[model samples]
Target: MPVVLQAGSFGRIRLIYVLVQYVDETPKFGHTAVDSSSGTPILNSSAAGVSPPTPAFTPSHYSHIYGSTPETLTTIDAPKNYGHAPWPRISPREACLLRYFIEELSRWFDLTDPHNNFATSIPQRARSNPILLDAILAASARHFSTLPSDQKAHIMSHYGLSPLPSHIHDSNSELSITEETVIHYHSRCIAELRVLANEPHAVMDEDLLAAVVVLRFFEELDNPFTSPPTETALHGLHVFLRAQASSALLVPGPRQASFWIGFRQEFNLAFSQQRNTNLPLEITDSYLIFTGAEDHVWTNRLVVLGARVLEFSYGSSPSNDLEFNELVRLRDEWVDKRPRSFAPIYTESPDMDTAFPKIWYTDDSHITAAQTLLLINILLLAYSPSIPRIGPSRRQTLESIDAQIRTIVLEICGMALSNRQSRPAGLTACIAINLCADRFTDPQEQRALMGLVVGTTRDSNYWPTKEAERRLRGIWGWDGDDD
Candidate 1:
């Protein structure tokens, strides 16, 4: 019997797996229909007419395309083998928008822009299922709403931005996203989840997985001050999607694999929310190498460390010398193993136009690198003050913590300079800077950091920047400068 990706089992999606080549543009899907011989046993929706047991979550395991080792993680209700889905009809307007995502939005997201394309299955699933189609349109609308109109034409020019029905202009010619629009599209996208409840296998579909993942991405789009985690605000939705993603060894195609690799970004965000949301999904060792690049590899490690920081902070996990020492070791190892290529590049061009270094960490991987550094700094800062009796003279340790924090805060502020476009991850640095502001008696550097955060908020329209700025203002007791 030919093998099929069985997503219904609440299985671990493998980090290390085979990459499937999606055939050329307009290519026919080459895989044969599911002819399951013996695979994971199906779970009955209820045992003796009562609700089935809540499966134990095994986060240590990974999803695999070949081996079934990670299959033991969890067992959710599953539809019979080779089951067919009820293909619901989503609007053509929405369908066209999904294409916009596939042809254009994908370029920005794992598309790596122009030269690269990931989530190849994103296109394949359009006609096959409404769940993915609605998801694409919903995310497309949200993304379009967030983009600065001036940047939209250039970023989405591949499909000729002029007169495209999706374009909606506002007073300042910026893409206008109304609260009503957000609710409408968000509902459209989220409604699909109801369909997947019965078909646990459907939730694991690659295109469906992509839909839910991007939907979570939209959660961060908010006012920062008042709105808290809109995309992630829904506890049950994020939990269910991740539960299924864990079981997926691979989404339908290799192009989609990159999306899963980068899943750590959203994963950490959900787990680190101030409310202390319980572990939604497990992080496996396989995910540590999402991108073959060293920067991505390093970033992945920092992501894991950040998770530990949150867990420790919330008292969900114990803080001991061993964990503390391991974190310190990881930090040093990351630095010691830094490749020459990734050696920080600081070019003080004689040209007056250049304000910051032409390149920071390395070409192409700057955001990921900067994010890694921010995570490391945040993790270290989280551990610095409360050294759980990890081999230290108390006075000396306090002194060292102060000194190290100063250095980290400076590096984090420097990171703001490289954030010319005001990328979303830049928000992380600003938040870290705000946290360390109280340590400095002089408000000058703290004030400068506040400026960067404020500037990024205006330029990027990335909401988290505003949250960081608001926190700083509160800390400094600043008055009515809501401008």
Candidate 2:
């Protein structure tokens, strides 16, 4: 007998308690475990007659407003050879969402990796993996809902996101096919994840991990002050990452990609909340050793270093001179030993039109690394422990710190403004602006900073800048009515 829990149209979850004689039983699915970095079998936890043994790491409690599973979004049978079957038939709206994902959203995930797995491999995998497809659809639909109305119509027609029911629009007004589509796919994915959470072996699936990572991004877009924080997606991420860390060796595929993406997400949250990141530093230290790796790997090394700087500034540990000196040493070493590719392709002083110097890089990775480096420097300077000094010397130290922070903020603005295509660079610039926006007292400089912040949201469409702008105005003591 099974106990069934029902909610609404989302469907029901049945909990069947089985009395097993053996505790240390192996999974009924045969074969010894191997690295899943290369193409591997994605287990179908939903399939019948497969009772997997209890996993070593259990999933955390996942509570969401949406309950139960919806109808299967795809017809592809699981536990089959991926890349062999034809793509499932999709509606025009789904097609448009997928196109939007490839053109816009994919770039966000593939920022660190030059290979662009999210852009190239993940989309292809989603065709066969329903969970991943649902996650992608959810994220794409949420992003589409955030765009300005005028641009939304243009994009919808361009990608054929049409033929929606006339009654879809409700009193909420923003609740069109876009928002409903997000909930539709998101709830379905959550229901599927709820099923998979019971099966321990499913946690090691790279595609499954990638699906959660994508959902985390969707949660970020859904956040923007309008909605309450639902850390359920983040908790799901911790569960999968912990399970992967405990059970399987971290390989260089989707799991690795998810790790980096998760780090960026965690970094943003930690920075904003002024708390240490939940991710372990030891795990991050193992990757990106910078021993003659590619330019992207080198940039990744700087990202790891930036995390250390962040921890130093916000972690519970008391700041010590030894750690501070070591951080400075590491920053200098990276600057000295980095490949020539990191050098800016061109540099121009601030002209009549621009307040910040224009700096350009040959590749997106270079500019991103440069932005991170500037941020690292800013944090170190701002949070450096004070030393005993005479009256005039104390004033001098304050001026020096102010000057350094101002310079870095300007450079970050310049990098973001110059390379408009690189969203990651713009994101890093946003962090810099958030931290040091008050340093700019001049009205013209303030407007320029606000433009970069506002422009990032306008260009990216995913990151909500309204709240950020509001915070900045409060800090600067400007009237709320003015933009």
Candidate 3:
């Protein structure tokens, strides 16, 4: 007769006893293993098969999460006469770089939000698709290419590779190496995705899109190009995303990835030629088809608005006082009517007595909320409205605008300060705060702002934070040169 396993009255694990005969002729002696979750098998005392000379199924780690596993998302047999390489083939050194990337890069990748973590999802997708795997490996290499000398040295040791000298440092050698790998993987992704692109309907080619997004990030984090294609990256990214958008437009499936790309393209605009903001038509279409989730929808709307401000302020779009008023009004309305789930962060108890060091990490609502506030701040601070020759100089308008910005900055600083060094939104908030650092208006507020930026640098040591320090210093004329 066989016995069944059961949970105890108080939900404690029941003792699982198995009869066993050992080589030492001991009866009922066996190795014990804990069952922490459902369906996992137990360990037996004997090295081979315990009690019986037969073996049963072992515990499996590859449980399906997406209803069913598709053949496309798995390892495949190499063809005898394939036109292209059947799988991604990397040298031993490149494999070492891949290992370094998998461990360190994933941490910062999801520093802000754990929802839909790209760190995990990208690698998992790679498991099923060799092209995606190559792309991720390439991405990780790109990240590796940017690390400081000591960090890269640690990576070399961690991944069992030869440590290079700090003098041969990350001037451009590593970047060049990674760029070759990226171009290689990108070429492969393009080939694979090009085949899928013409399928008349939207293909669920998330891995490819993800690779593009990652590559875009690599470009954004890039140091001043020893190479060209800063402009080319923007153009290629826009064109590929536009193609994806066209597919989504023709066939209505889950277009969340397209929406994601639109947001990315808008963010990428910060570094692009502002006058060239005539984006693809598909970005708008994707947003239109987006189901209205209050927080995300409005935030993306703000992204479009900020892009418009940039477009109009520059020579790209024709602008007037009415257009400027409309953009300001839209931002104001969004600020006023944000949803409860993502309401703007504020100082509670008048002194921020109740807030944590980084409330956004504790409160899910504040993450996107801070982002919206920051985008609005950036739009107002960075771009002029292009109002042609107004009477009274719009002095009152400027003062009012300054006041609105002042309040938002202090509030964000309060949240960031409360959240301290470990806050998720600190980098995001600090970036915007640095852009608007000139409007802080008071000496103490400026000091607090300085402290926040410095503390963030000490704690997180992100490249953007270092840039923010430079920007903040420039705002106060602490640096002799104007940025």
Candidate 4:
């Protein structure tokens, strides 16, 4: 098997590895076949039994990817030490939202962690931490508010029926969540946080870190795709992160997990507005050293690389040849040194109906890492500081850049569309679409891209994609009714 790197034609680095035969089996997250042109789900169902375990690769094979001796590989040994806390009492309706979070919404946060502590550990911690509990409830309630009536009924049906709050209802007499309803939980979280903020060690508290991260999701839901916020009320998030960085609290566990999620969130805001992120690089760099052995550690490396790219793109310092070359080298090293597990399990070229190819990974971590790699390439290509060329040379350089970008963007979309079982995959697709949707002038291809964005927003109920769709249509000069 040869892995193709999409930096450019001259930049392609092929990795030689043993080809594992493709087995036609149920995907781990089940399968959802999408209509590429319309982003419509053609079939959505789960299969019994787990996917067969991945074929084991030898230690020597792993060494080839890690660029070190087998003995040098450090296994991640973080203790799960989430001690017990007294479970809190809540009304029957809040109970339904809590269950909804465990069953459905936690996947959004845990998409890249196989251990899934958001579903397992965060809820456990929330039992005793009212701030954390309120943040989770607020995020869950906002997500729940987006569901269609029938789907909400289906989800509510699983949890025992509970009486809806009178205030939650609209004039239509049907069940509807008011803005005040979500804010009720959100404001409670912030107000309590104000008291905790006065304490010297509050930033060092991992539970508080996780709560703030959860609230960031709620902030995203409220102002999806908004500008680099200046006057937003959630300003305390940056203060906590900066203070926490100094307190040396970014150790490996829930704190590190929240760090990665917070980094990604900060990255999204920075990229959207062409501004530098407030996340401290020295703190994040400690985790990106690539010394650990967990799958999430590898994913976090790509996450950090994204931040470095953004810094180079939008930082106030003048660009120098050394900085540009270093960024390029880091990106190249990451692609060449990724573990074998990051390789796609299956691949198929795009057919007549689809705008992108079908490349599938084994699980959420692999999917996220692959998509992040594509995103890094897109950023590098978009912000490359290559010297100016004149006449035909300039035109040639422009064409080459556009080709590389389209190639990377298509792969990004392919990964997301193929792995729709993971919710964050679709969100990644929306991010790419927002970045490069205008590059394509072809009508059919544009429609397919729009379908993926709009379809993902519809299916996932992630409001960011809805905002992304509006921006894309505006960029393409598409009327609201145009397909």
Summarize candidate 2's per-residue lDDT along 209-264 as a digit string, tens digits: 78878988887775642233344566656655655653322455666777678766
TM-score of each: 0.62, 0.75, 0.56, 0.76
Give the whole-model CA lDDT for all candidates, comma-separated. 0.48, 0.67, 0.48, 0.67
lDDT assessment of candidate 4: 0.67
lDDT of 1 at 199: 57
Compose the digit string of candidate 1's lDDT tens values, residues 299-359.
5455555555555555545456576666677666665665556565773322333222333
Error of 3 at 79 (Å): 27
Candidate 1 Cα deviation (angstroms), residue 239: 3.7
Q: Name the lDDT value of residue 476 in candidate 2.
A: 77
lDDT of 3 at 152: 62
Error of 2 at 71 (Å): 50
Model 1 stretches with alpha carbons more than 4 Å out: 1-124, 146-181, 223-262, 266-283, 286-295, 312-318, 347-359, 364-366, 384-400, 419-422, 464-467, 481-483
Any runs in candidate 4 off by more than 4 Å, and if so which? 1-86, 162-178, 230-234, 246-250, 286-288, 387-391, 464-466
Number of backbone collisions per candidate, in order? 8, 0, 6, 0
Candidate 4 lDDT at 322 equals 82
Clashes of 4: 0
| Model 4 agreement with the true structure over 319-421: per-residue lDDT tens digits | 6668878878877777777787888999999888888999998778888888888877877776777735466677778778888887788888898889888
- Assess candidate 4 and give its TM-score to the true structure: 0.76
